[model samples]
Target chain A: MSTPFIITKASGESETFSLEKLRHSLLKSGASPETTEDIIEELERDFYSGMRSRTLYKKAFSLLRRRYKAQAARYQLKKAIMELGPSGYPFENFVGEIFKAQGYTVEVGVILQGHCVRHEVDVVAENETERILVECKYRNTPGFKCDVKIPLYVHSRFQDIEKEWRKLPGNHHKKIQGWVATNARFSGDAIQYGECVGLQLLGWDYPQSRSLRKWIDEDRLYPLTALTTLSKSEKQRLLEKDYILASELVSSPHCLEILNLTARRKHQIQNEVRQLCGNGD
Target chain B: MSTPFIITKASGESETFSLEKLRHSLLKSGASPETTEDIIEELERDFYSGMRSRTLYKKAFSLLRRRYKAQAARYQLKKAIMELGPSGYPFENFVGEIFKAQGYTVEVGVILQGHCVRHEVDVVAENETERILVECKYRNTPGFKCDVKIPLYVHSRFQDIEKEWRKLPGNHHKKIQGWVATNARFSGDAIQYGECVGLQLLGWDYPQSRSLRKWIDEDRLYPLTALTTLSKSEKQRLLEKDYILASELVSSPHCLEILNLTARRKHQIQNEVRQLCGNGD
Candidate 1:
């Protein structure tokens, strides 16, 4: 008679286990033929006598996901963006904010019209004497070549904007200036065209020097450098009003400079606080 | 006694074999003691009999050669370059060559001067009265941000160049009659700058539209067209003259285009060669 199955024990012992043997080992000592068949089928699929088969199953599972799902993929992307921080925001808007923060009176996302085309300019910054237009671009890939179409298009669009500016009331619009900021690189021909027409091709690096990186490095307006100088008590009141944020600002380089500039005054203030508190600590 | 090495050669059988057992098994075969030691060493290292060790040796040899030798590495790099073809070359140079091959008069490396920067244009192409400049950038990774320094520096450099060009002699000497190109991408500020200066920022798609891809695929030459234009007898004399590198002229796009343009009526000469048994096949 043939044995239906066999078992190799850990102690290096081997035994033939027939259906009769299985029934004998079971607690109830009785099983229906159908139940026996089902159990055997499951055992064949799930239980292997060797370790290698178990490893293979685990390896296969690791190589594949549970199933394809779009929602899960999007969640991962959103999580990644949120973690990358402020510089990761929409490229043009980020630069525009940087320019505004840099003490330039600015208008961002302005529309410009040209002779044959119309487009939007990203920023227009002005002072009492001069005006400048700024455009920002965010490019992800390499190999964008700027050539004829770009200059012709921008010139046409700028023309329309220039016409509208000419109609602006009084000298308020007289100093309006134009600029383009691109994250992508430009070709030589495009640069020459811009030169011929008096336009600027501020590729990726120029604006970083002028704006965004400047702000992150802590160039901000504060009390000492305020447009209007303040009295001692008024400055104290202002500091108290924003104490938590003011303290948090200490980590910035610009704030450190500000603190250094006011060292003598800060010492006096600290003495007063100490006198009131006594040796309480 | 010490534990003995064991191998179960038969089912339901358990046995232990020591060096003494091994000696007895081999003694009747008349192998020497040194031969037995060699056999034992091999068995120890490769206990799992079915596995082949040659693959490990081969991999080790390859690693040694690749790390220690320059020629092997260069050979691998060359093969990879050939495999990647046009895409493998710097995008700026590759795209410029494509335009040159297309019968356009092309200057591969050009320097453009702008009011605020100097830009190295990748290719300057002129056809009749039309002229354009191009820049190409190759990116291996996605989500690339343009560094602001280079473009701004270039802009500043361009300004100096332009200042010189504005002078009388330089004005005529340094006129770029066209656009700029970038393979990677431009930022919003760059686009605005382009507008301000009348430079065109042509995207990658624009150049690809001019059949640069198709020309590369078909290996078509302008010289073939020129050659077809030459009269039969004149074409024969020209081919016999050996004034040009026939192989390079046949293969190079620039040379081929020139030949096609110059050989406007030379197709009949090919028929004569065919009739004169020139076909070795």
Candidate 2:
């Protein structure tokens, strides 16, 4: 059979796999269909064969992924609830969502390493003069008997961030202060740790009633819509799992057959079932 | 119940969970007597009071994990069939493992942007003169037909790596070549892509007597003895799904339990069966 993408076969008569055909195949394989179209359009515009190699396509895909991720983050923030020790993403979302509700422009999950890769604070809120680094912890259980380990770790990471901020290129060196937020109440030791480190600690009892009037007036917080897309079911599901499963449930016929056969073979089936259910233990 | 290690209770007196007292509890939990001693020692090292911090312990655990991973990689290499495609890791393991195998010692997963992040090519073997970008692909199938996307993507990544390599600091403007080894063979397009990008393609070809000797002499291969400590039964169970799974299976009680269940379910007490007898999948 002729290859789907039409190109002049060695016999050399002007033939080509229509860009449209390439897109169709990518969609069939579960690729982001729109991505293929846009990429094809861009590639066609710059199609000098092998002049500029793979970096061009890599950049295109990277842009697409970043766009998708940013949009998802925004959508999630609007619908987030009082997330308890949530994983990295949800915790950041909660912090940004809270700030948005109170009218603050917030950026979540920015990488700041040692000077460049130091600490990755969950959320950073900026108004005009002041910048707030909000570290959010989403816990499954909400209790005051919090683990000292989590806060201490958070504190160490914060210290690293502070050290980096001290070296910020511009005026940011003076505008930033760190704050920690958690769904669960903090232990006294954690508060002591925060106090010792000169960081603000905001547990479940952060003064949510005041609405951060200073933040609003100074435009420290911008009013962004709370994430409205999160379904209650999705939120509940998020609360239940500590980790994300890399693979989606494969509902293909092959998977079904394997599951059926393995299920019948008790020992292997048990292992398979456990894996399917995410019980690595 | 008293904690496993010494805990100065709320009253603040020196208290200890003695070995003799803990022995009964350990036995009840099905731990062997020898295992109990190991457990107590570990618990003693890990235990702390006054709002215990687990970060240090976690760091220790993480260190152990890294050491175990390095050891595991060595073992897997030893068992690697000389002709197995790129060392027969799963399609996903291709790049990362090869990079690890070659000592790029950097994480490739961090740069991967795709749906199959679990299947990543993230290892780069780097030195002053040359850098080999190793992308591993482990497949259940034995042909290269179904597994071209990865090599294609990896070839694309290599192009990106080359572009980035030019921008690196100092006088180190070295070229980074790519190698892709998969348990499966390459599809026509994958091979074409590899060729287009100058990737060294390692496909599955059983080593002839002469080839084995060559591999041993080059010191480019891993020895099987150092790859794993799994029992024969465990190895058989893992190899059944994808022969590549032999490298992925971690020996633990859970894995053993799964194996036991699988065997019992496969043959309901028929004729006597050897524990490790099965054709490698």
Question: How does candidate 2 score on lDDT?
Answer: 0.46
lDDT of 1 by residue, A1-281 (tens): 13344455455565443545443433243434554444444445554444243342343232221111111222232222222222322445444545655577766677665432345676777777766776554454455555533553454445556766676677554665556565556666666666677776666333345532223224321112111122444433434433211122333324333334476655443433232222321
Q: Categorize the docking of model 1.
A: incorrect
Specify the poorest-scoring 10-residue window by lDDT in model 2 chain A. A243-252
Model 1 spans > 4 angstroms off = A1-84, A88-164, A167-173, A178-281, B1-89, B102-106, B112-116, B125-132, B137-176, B180-211, B214-281
For model 1, residues B112-162, the per-residue Cα lDDT tens digits are: 654444556667776654555554444434443333222332343344444
* Candidate 1 TM-score for chain A: 0.40
User: How many residue pairs in model 2 have overlapping backbones?
Assistant: 54
Candidates in order have lDDT scores of 0.42, 0.46
DockQ (C-alpha based) per candidate is 0.01, 0.01
Estimate the TM-score for candidate 1.
Answer: 0.32
